[model samples]
Target chain A: MSEYIISLAGLTKKYGALTAVDRLDLSIRKGEVFGLLGPNGAGKSTTILMMLGLTEPTSGSVQVCGIDATMHPVEVKRKAGYLPDEVGFYEHRSGLENLLYTARLNRIPVQEATERAYLLLKRVGLYEVAHKKTRTYSRGMRQRLGLADVLIKNPEVIILDEPTLGIDPRGVREFLDLIVQLSREEKITVLLSSHHLHQVQQVCDRVGIFVGGRLLAEGDIPTLSEKLFAGEPYIIEAGVQPLPDTARLQTVLQDIEGIRSIQFSEGLFRIGCQRDLTSAIAGAIVRSGLALTHLQRKTYGLDDIYNRYFEGGPVYEQTA
Target chain B: MIFITATLKEDLSMNRLLNIVALLKAPPAATGRAPHPFRAIVDKEVSDHLRSWRFNILLVLILLTCFGSLYISVTNIGKAVKPDDPDGAFFFLKLFTASDGTLPPFHVLIGFLGPLLGISLGFDAINSEQNGGTLSRIMAQPIHRDYLINGKFVASLIVISVLFFALGFLVMGLGLIIIGVPPTAGEFLRIIFFILLNILYVAFWLNLSILFSVLLRQAATSALAGIAVWLFFTIFYQIIIKLVAKALMPSEMASGQAVLHYQELILNLFRIVPSQLFSDATTTLLMPSVRSLGPLTMEQVYGAIPSPLPLGQSLLIVWPQLTGLIASTVVCFALSYFSFMKREIRPR
Candidate 1:
């Protein structure tokens, strides 16, 4: 089993009467792309800050790379890289200069820092614009520069908050690819938080869904999907050919026990059923004698699991 | 045992060699080789301030005030010494007037220019960092919070000192060129002391301004608060003190004696205020023979007046007030550092 590289135990942070993060416990293992998925104001940034040792947690403790973050924040910080959500740079400094300053802050020597900064800038596709003041850089370029700054220290664990925010699709893809490459080549642990589930789904090995300052669920995609959907499976097809009406499909599937919900796509039928109803669903499809070209259990994506776990109804309603 | 010791020695040497190689391969320090944290911080602050337009405007304003005061002094110097007058040599005495005689030239400049530079340099020192989103980033480094505040304070003091010396020398050079006669050694020493006091007084204001900057979050608010405080000290504070003294003290005493008694009471009360103490100390330094600004009796003037206190005593007298300014500056900075350390770096 892989050892956990970062751990938070019973962590709680309170601002006056408001609890920004409450009784949070997380354990991220080495070399895993762990995505923190949440909506706005979901305490994602607060959690990240606590991990980075920038904010004091009101209770409990955090350990990064076996070092107690609260007790030894400097050591923890030395081994961890943080990219804040809205990355701000010294406007008077060039992009390369800003990265070099960060490198120096991490105690890197000047000559090597300059060379590494130039290499990172080039890696982020910003070498040509290295000499320009950060104020003149576009949001995308600035975001890339922020990434480059974080990489200057060659940290073991990278904590990126909203890494893809304010970036175009192309930039986002390139960023994701870079992150994947980092994980594979450098054995770096990544904790990425984003509101974009599709992007999270594309890269994360495991995902945690946070809502209202509480982590609702966390698991690999399949495990989370199984938990949220209660092991119910579905079949989906995509094509512009007319399918049976929803009522007819419901009628046909209702008599077959263990089937739960029947949804109709444009030219397809999505059949959701109980854990042991896959065989029954196939039989019913065969009995209906409709051209059953595609019959397979469908896996839920991160979006479906996110919606199931976090949307519409509160996880627990206290009010009568 | 000997074999084990040899293995241990070899391992230690190899580890030391690897550590040295790592240090060599690491990035160079940003400012130069062996970047001292204090120097890096000072250089960064100076460069950043120089790049800012507000600092440029402040520089222009300081130059204008410096040259403006000097020009007025040069034009008015000769008037004090009328042409074909028999006491032309004593015209220098006219330059040292109080209510009894004039003030020294540099003293007048200090009284006028100290606050301008002090308030301008420091009113936005902390607030601008808070506004610019750099405060947290700086604090996040491994350095202690006090280092950041101390570094900034020292950098500002250096900048103010440089500006004062530049202006002081320029004025002295102009005086030499315009007035053909070089100042006496005593006059030159007195001017140098006057410049030192002026810089110290300005440093006091800078400390106060930094205190206000720490208290206020926005740059505009801090600047406005500092200027408002300055205005109260410069204009309304003395008037309030006088009115309070009149209402509180006995007023039916003999006329000239009442003036002396009232002046003493007001001066005492004013000593509690920093600006007043600074002004009184500076005025005393400039005019060595000033007994009082109140009405003076001929008997009292004729009697053997005591010699002026030495410069060390003057500094000792104002030491509490200076300490008060520094203490307040530190208190404000500590509060700011605490709050800044606690504040979440979120979008407004």
Candidate 2:
């Protein structure tokens, strides 16, 4: 097995009577994009801080790149880069200057730091206004600059707390695309913490949904759905053309052995089934000669999982 | 000139020279561990303080009053009461501690303004980092958490010492130009101690302000807390001490020794206020003929001596005040360090 780059064992953090992170165990493999998904105050940031050794865990350990993070936080930090939820830069400093300061902190030489700073600013599409004070830049530019700050040390693992927070939709897309590219091309393991699942869904290889300081489920999208929704119906949603009558569609779907339930409206049919029997259902619809314009599986995203898990419903545990 | 000009870009401020050397020589790549991060933090914080309006406004305030004090001292020193008076020995430094008529002396001004300077510099130091959202980002770097606090402390101390020394030397320089009297070696040593006293006294306030900054969330709240503490010590503290002393010891029916004891008790109580410590240290250091901070009994002063104490003897006498200022500073710093370490950096 490939070694896990980031590993936590029984990690717990408590404040007086309140447990912020409780009895947590997680592992993120090298070069994998792992998202820690949780709502506000659900301890996602606390977990991230513990993993980086910024916040000491009440019990247990964090191992980053084979180093004990708690015992050797600086060493782990040297190999890890963190972008906090709200990325702050010195307002009086130029974007390039801020990055250079981080570079110098990481002990990059002056000439080399300046060069790397310029290159990273350009990489983040902030080179045009690299010389302007950060206060003048938009929130998006400051975030991109924060990314540049983290990358200055060439960290082996990048920890981003709410990477898409407070960014415009366009900026979010650009930023996520950059993250995906960084993971793929640079082979850097990324641990992204966010309450929003759709944002992580676009880039994460695996995700851990946290509720009440407890990780409820951990897996890829399909794996999680299959496990959580096992014995529950798989849904197929379709839109039909030609002022479609519901009778024909229902009649066609009635013949399918796997079909559990079907509901048809003006042009839409929400079909619940034992499995993904879209091909069979679609074949029957075609045979009945109703023009099927669109056909897709009705998916259960993270919000549904979060709600179910939060409502004290069962979640699938990773068996192996 | 051209070659030097080219290198000037690299070392614009002598500030970053140590950082450059640290970065260039055996960077993390070679050693597999980066150099200490405090240098970078110190450099950044130093620049921030320099560009801040708080520092600029105070700089102007101090310069105006100090130069005014210098002008007054120069004019006053023109007429002398005696050729060999003890105060005449350190005529040059007298400009720093003696008032003409209207404004307070340089030492008194510093004794009052020093805490305000300290508070302004540091009251928002950490909380502003939190408010601006940079604390987490910097803490995430590959540096010890201790570096953050130590870096800020060292940087502010550097600035405080520089400001005090520059002003002290300027007043001395102006005294030289106007009065043409150079200070003796003992007088020069006394001046150095006076400036050192200012730094330690202001550093106490700086530490206190940082402590408040760590405890309070908003920058404005921390600033207010800092100023409030300053006000308490500068104004309310003495009044409260007097009231407490009066209640504790009734002088109307008390014996002479009891009154002396009461006076010493009140003076000891004043030691708690950092401004008082500063004032006591400055007066004793500047005016050597002044014997002590507390009331002296007739028996203790039976010798009737009016000689200037040596630098060592004077320091010995006021060592408690000096140590008291520094100890409080250390305690406040310790509090800030522990609070910052324990503080969970998550946003509210």
lDDT of each: 0.70, 0.82
User: Residue by residue across A1-320, what tens digits does model 1's lDDT show?
Assistant: 23999998999999899998988999999999999999988999888878877778999889898888777777787778777766778888998878876766666766667666765776688877887999899887877887788777777888888988989999899989988886776688999999999999999999989888888889998888777777455534322123667676666567777655666544556666665566666666667765566665667887777766666653223111
i-RMS for every candidate (Å) is 9.4, 5.7
lDDT of candidate 1 over B1-348, digit per residue (tens): 234224323534667655533542343345356465556677767776667786688788667756665656666776655464433533332233312123235455456657767778788876676666556455444454455666777888888778777776777777677766676554555556666766777777777777777777787787788788778877898799878986877656658666777767776677766666566665655544444533556786796545544445545555665565556556655665666555554421
> CA lDDT of A318 in candidate 1?
19
| CAPRI-style quality class for the chain A–B interface of candidate 1 | incorrect
Best model number under TM-score:
2
lDDT by residue (B1-348, candidate 2, tens digit) is 234224533533566544433432322355334445678889888988999998999999999889887777677775632576777666676777666578888888888888889999999888888888888888888788888888999999999999999999998887888778789999999999999999998999999999999999898999999999988887899899988986898558879978888788888888888888888888899888778778878888998767778889889878999999889999999999999998877642
Name the runs in model 1 displaced over 4 angstroms. Answer: A235-251, A262-271, A275-297, A312-320, B1-33, B78-113, B176-193, B212-215, B238-249, B253-265, B268-273, B291-302, B306-309, B316-321, B342-348
CA-based DockQ, model 2: 0.43
* C-alpha-based local distance difference test score of model 2: 0.82
